[model samples]
Target: MNRLQLAKRLAAMSVVLPAAASFIWEELLWLHALALLWLAGAAICWIGIERKHHSGQMRRTIHTLQAASNRTLNHHRHDWMNDLQVLYGYIRMQKPDKMVECVEKIKDRMAEESRIAKLGEPALIHYIQSFRTLTNAVQLRVEIAEGVHLTELPVDSSGISESLIEIMNAYRFAAAPALGEPAVLTMKLSMDDHALYAAFYYQGELTSEQRFASKINQQLEGAPLRPVEAGQPYGNMLLRAEWRA
Candidate 1:
């Protein structure tokens, strides 16, 4: 086990040992007071240690998130600058069609991002939007079907959000495409018959297909969503999940 878990176990043992001693030694009944004091001290120390560990974890999480945020901002800035340069070059060349196409691409990207932001879960939205900055293992595209609001659905929003995150993580880490080719995963979220559905279309190779399938199954255990169908069609993996009320 990790050091933190080990330390917690030791602290618990310390508290339990004293109580056990008091209970075992009848003649040391008078020592019950001492044992009680020892237990109390140990419990307080355990609490302090737990709090300190959690505080450190929180700080680390915040720092990592801030770093991710900064990277995302820088990447976006670079992309915008590139787009502007392309637009400027098109203008200089008097290529109106190319310029229009570039502008349309930008607009489409903005519209998709807007829909992602409105997914109704802050963590899900942030994770989806910042996924590219976090990793290049998978080229991820998330599309939310129009008129679907996760928060408005009569289902477990947080659970669904967490499950989707887990599902993405399974694919993200397992992604290992062939030489000179990157893995691509397109996720489409939609609602049907008062139920939420997520469909993942993956185009690439995995280092270990069995391991990836195992990870997906493990994450879905007891989750709010369950797999509807998973298969490989025309050499591509397609996975679909439906929210179970």
Candidate 2:
């Protein structure tokens, strides 16, 4: 079940807990204690579910990183040497313009890679990378605004991680291409005015866009990951996840 449904059930149990004690008389007093214990168990169960989710994210993050590295090595076994050799050839051929363009692109890519490490927020960095392996058709694109350097957020992130995961999963499911065209999913992370910001956008098919958006917004109800603006941009969807600075 979704977190909201779980929360509603837990709230119901909480309401019933106090009333349960009044119904027990002296002879049945032990039953009241049992009921209290049962309520405590339910609370613990809820907490456990949250912890389990966090653990799952961490595991997925590690797996995704491993898979990404493997894919990179397999795909680019000769890429480094090839690029440099090509650049060297350009120089020998008196192609200064081409050489400058190639070097600029390479530097830009390296800068982006460096930004990921400088993010400093392990969970966010890993989450961004996890998209690499999350789906095949959806090409995940992450843009870190220049000067975006983050420190460790809350241990639990107050649901930022969970909400972003939910949104991403929805987009993943919605990314099935009808015309064999691939989907381009973009996410931007940055900081402004004492708040951290994340915005997601995707161009793809969604079985139910309304349902997808609602599910995402629900997870971002409180604390970290507050929504500044959440809606569809043109044909794409966006959820701006944020936390206090």
Candidate 3:
């Protein structure tokens, strides 16, 4: 349910509440019985409103993550194409020394990208590895805490993997130019009886546009699950889901 639907349910409850309460207090047997029915209806309405709110929050969070992931993927595609063109031009120039240098640079870059791009399910492991690879390329450090498991989480494994890849790609592209030296990207994964969680930390300030896009995407989806706040000198991304075990 959306805000409008929630409001309507609340309004219906408000109207029925007083009528039912008054009839029940008056000790009018038949009227009291009818009031009891109204009260039950009001309770149902309240439950609906609450469920809607929870659902809305979840939806918002999921959408935000998805949009961020798509943007990252698109950015990678653009950069990869541009890089290929440059490599192509270098090859066509027929300058042996420059071609060799260009080939080496392109080869290393492609290799790193491939490592992250190749990640697939099991999503928990893939995300942990991908985050580690991305942050390491930037010279950031990552630590995986104990208890992070992917085995029984209540989320789509493929979707989680895709989202993680997209976010990492976005961070890499955004920070590439600013990287004066190699930086580190760190990740930690843990799980318990009740939940599964993954956390990523990268050095550098995330851009305003990235932050804004994240927020907009979250609101549009209506979910409470938003990215967690990071401390100074680091940016963080947190993904979590309830566990069935």
Error of 3 at 57 (Å): 3.4
Q: Candidate 2, after superposition: displacement of residue 19 in Å?
A: 38
lDDT against the true structure, per candidate, is: 0.80, 0.67, 0.56
Stretches of candidate 2 exceeding 4 Å from the true structure: 1-69, 72-89, 152-162, 178-180, 230-245
Query: How far is 221's C-alpha from truth in model 3 (Å)?
Result: 33
The number of the candidate with the highest lDDT is 1
Per-residue lDDT tens digits of candidate 2, residues 65-131?
A: 7887777555444656777898999999999999999899788867877887776756666666556
lDDT of each residue in 67-101, candidate 1, tens digit only: 98898888878988999899999999999999999
**TM-score head-to-head 1 vs 2, winner:** 1
| lDDT assessment of candidate 2 | 0.67
* TM-score rank order: 1, 2, 3
**Model 3: ten consecutive residues of lowest lDDT:** 224-233
Give the higher-TM-score candidate: 2 or 3.
2
What C-alpha lDDT, on a 0 to 100 scale, does residue 63 get in candidate 2?
A: 100
Q: Once model 1 is optimally superposed onto the true structure by TM-score, how far is the C-alpha of residue 243 displaced, in angstroms?
A: 7.4
Best by TM-score: 1
